[model samples]
Target: MGGKQPVTIMTDQCSAMDKAIREVFPKSRHRLCTWHIGENAIVNIKGVMAKDGFKPRFDYVLKYTDTIAEFQHYWNSLMTDYNCKTHKWIERLYDLKEKWCPAYNKEWFSWGILSSQRSETTNHSISRRLHKTNGLCDFYKCFLDVIDEWRSKENKGDYNSSTGNRYYSCADNMLCFHARNVYTIAIYLIFEQRFIKVIGLRCQRISYEFLVSEYIVGHPTKDFIRHVVKFNEQEMVVDFTCKSYGEIGILCSHILRVFIVHNVEEIPKQYIMKRWTKEAMNTIVEEGEDRDNEEYIGGVEGDGNVSNKYVRDETLLDVIEPSIDTVLPDVVEPIVEKVIPTMIQNPPKRKRKIKNGTEKANERNMRPKGIVEKKRNKLKGWNKRRERHVDNLREETQSTDKCMYHKFTCWWGFGSSNIFKFTIGSICSR
Candidate 1:
């Protein structure tokens, strides 16, 4: 990371790793994986887990508590009721609660990841392709294959994001339209979920000072868990107490509710993270870099007016008003006519050709089959044969129970019959 340590590092609970992180990256927050913690609980508290309602209560304490006070209250109650107050593993977990507890780690930016399960999943995939007897060269080759598969998946996602059309629940909202154009398909879906949640939320402004306003946002039924949103009217910036945007780079539902109340047309440019956008892979020029050869600015190509690309539409009136005094009336009319026509001209839409029934059937028949389809057909055939064999054995056992019983007692005298009877019994029982 360019010699800079990450803000947070998540790992399974290990004393050596904990010591190393504390020594090497003193400033970085070290987090314990919640999945590992839960897995450890199965081994450490098997007796407690066997009791009714213990698992659900444990899960609730681990995941649902949102404040330090709430966590402490529930944790103490759990320990008392479960009689695990003196349990060694539970005591150790309590000592490191800040590392694994959601309430304690909420302020940190983790990209919405609560555990290292994603890395574990990748490891599982790699392990399936590897062997204990594999050589170093074979291992390297397998690693490259895994990397290529990941890149292929990324390319497929990019293709879908670029070409796929998504249905918007709030089709009339300008903010939703702006999100659809700016964000990638996956990120847009996540944003849309938050946008849809705005319908259930209610926002009320509590204070106003200068250009800043503070609002309380929450659902009608949940008055106790309200979120505070602070909005700056001048800068068009919003801050939520949940810090969801800081952690995940996506605005929370509470902030969106505030925007709806204020009649905000589009998400502010500052809030729209470039990493989540469809143009995430586009080359970004740094400040003081040469831009003479650059053809595009703000998605517009070959535009001579560079200033307009950086300025917002609402601020254009202010800019043009000051320049009106210096501009000649004869020159202004021609400039307006030339720019207005080019700016408003819509691109021509492609005509769609409806396919007939025969044409569609032919296209389907001509489509090339892949290895996956062949494997699926082979699996289906195997399953059918197995089912038939089981049914035959079941019927034979039911019809010839007396003969099978005699064969079982006289196995030495009738070897083949004994083996057949054994097979029939096993299959029927299964």
Candidate 2:
């Protein structure tokens, strides 16, 4: 957002959007929304997709296959089996497979967001307060409202990460004690889950060295997937063949199991990705302190356009610096706290006239009396017309009622009308 391109961008299949993205963000991987493509397939090839096993097989090829070879084989087999080789939609999808297929795009970290469905959901939320007929000003205000709501949630997350502490019973038992203090609440929960899951895993040492070891790990699963873990004891580094850390920025259960087996009491600093830690955002803010502060603190030097600083802007940092200074370690916290408020707040721009009650009363009296009386007369005349209209409706209703009663009695004698009336009365009485 700050001249730093996104790793990936997902949108529905629109040629214009695709062309624009290619020109504007050529480095960013552009992905078509899987949800949109699936919906388009349903609409365009409903008959083909509804055939026995067609839909499931298509989904399996798209989502389940993990390798390019497996994906291509399954996809080709499906096309041949269904005789869908002639389908234009299928042909187009095959051409663009890497944009939507998980197997083909495994190199990019999509964060498990395979579709634009979440963006669509956010669009619906923002649109709920908007309308097609809205003017530009109204739409702009609504957009700001939606942005404010999203920013408020981000601020809440920051506040919680900075001040909140979570203590699990297992925290005292293993490296979780250190993790609870280092990671944010949501991230700590994820790490704690891996720690808890490590209990169910059984690891067998496959090879050993002075500082490196390899292990085969087993867990209960439908497919019975065995995981391989390699560890460097001296460096306290662990690697799982699954590459969970590389892909998702979190250590896998296999690595956790290895760590527990090796009695690693704390996570290595190198393995502790700052992006997942509670102080991640604050760390960026501290790093990007003003030139004066950096000079005084002897902070690292870099051109202001370093491009990778993660804080939203200096404004967010200003809002958070006060509370952060109070909570962070004394060595890292700035000694000059009072200057932050002065830097954040600006002097009043202008003055306004504050009038007493008599002056306000005189202003109100300055309005023309005739206009007020005209409004009251207009309201009274409208009420009178409504009352007259109501009276006419009542008269018409009474006439219709009388006609119905007399006609029923005359046409069907006492037997038909009276019996029908009695039945209705009995039903109502119950």
Candidate 3:
């Protein structure tokens, strides 16, 4: 009997995806992953209160909705109380009633369809592989390797390649070796293609010194693990240990060093790996694949390399910010956008202006409400806006605290007067 008992696939209950799959698999039914469905319903569909007030109502809806009548009853009550009749998410859900009501499609919907524990299980398991990575570069390499390897395993293929060619997955078992991976890398180096395929690797003169300088701008932790450079004072050989994603592999750093420091135009071949190479990327393989399209992994993935122009990481989000055309309005610079506080409309101009005799407020109490206030009310009035209109001469018995503009025939006032008198006298003589 050729039949699939069923393979459970858990994904976020995104309507676009559900709709897309719905169009393709008309006969193949889908039960919404209830936990994700609930999450989406709460986050995108309905809002649970920010405070804990919404918990009982949310729990009531979740618990009582095992059957369609119960669900509808609770839903109607909720809709009435929250004014959810006008809510777009609730309207949309009702529009797609067939997907939500279990009784409407019992063959597809069941207790197995809902998954709340899977997420918790996955989170607990993630800690088993935590706290690793020697330096940033090595961590990124291992990071890419892990993704490719996992994707390949998930797809049951070598790796997902953009190009129509096949490439084997870079074995991420290397991540397990990490700081010990150099000895393991030497073992894989015997494969010959691993290091010998590039000219920079063959020549050995690319800047082993520079890549080991640790130009990594921003990383929160891992101060002990850094760029290691052992210069051969005698033989003139350099061994640079570079780290990325928990692995410290021996890199032919000379080329990367030269390119970084000297601003060399040609990227050395020694730096070419399946991760960024077109061949590696095209085939999702450890060898001969192109992976440039995977820039989204580094750019939007929110890794910390935002400070480095060449690197993108979550902690270093600004590093990638300059690289991407963050198309803000030409008039709206990001710096200005960040610094400028949002100006709110000044409380809608009090449409019903205060009528007279409403309070103990006196006309004397509110005299044009000078832009600045002589009175010490905290709400500054228009009186604050006034600057003293300075006069030319000081009052008799000149006050010690005289305005500087009128201190003693202010030069500003007298200088112009002298010029005016001279001009007038010259004109009369003429």
Query: Candidates 1 and 2: which is better by TM-score?
Result: 1
Q: lDDT values of the candidates?
A: 0.71, 0.66, 0.38
- Point to the candidate with the largest TM-score: 1
TM-score of 2: 0.58
Model 3: lDDT equals 0.38
Per-residue CA lDDT of model 2 for 1-430, tens digit only, reads 5687888899999999999999999988899887788899899999998887677667666655544544665576678778998888888888999888876666566765778888788889878998889999998899999989999987776786676534354846658888877877667666766677788777778678787898766554311224567899887777664555654566777888888888888888876778788777676564556887665444333644422243345667888899876677664536556666676686333333345533222233333444224433454576569656644533332232223334322322233214224322211222
List pairs with backbone clashes in candidate 2. none
Residue-wise lDDT of candidate 3 within 69-144, one digit each (tens)? 4345445655655655787776776776555444344334233344546666655544344456456776566566
Higher-lDDT candidate of 2 and 3: 2
* Per-residue lDDT of 124 in model 2: 95
Ranking of predictions according to TM-score? 1, 2, 3
Q: What is the TM-score of each candidate against the true structure?
A: 0.62, 0.58, 0.26
Winner by lDDT:
1
> What residue runs in model 2 are displaced by over 4 Å at the alpha carbon?
64-88, 283-430
Of models 2 and 3, which has the larger TM-score? 2
In candidate 3, how many Å is residue 322 off?
Answer: 74
Using TM-score as the measure, name the better of candidate 1 and candidate 3.
1
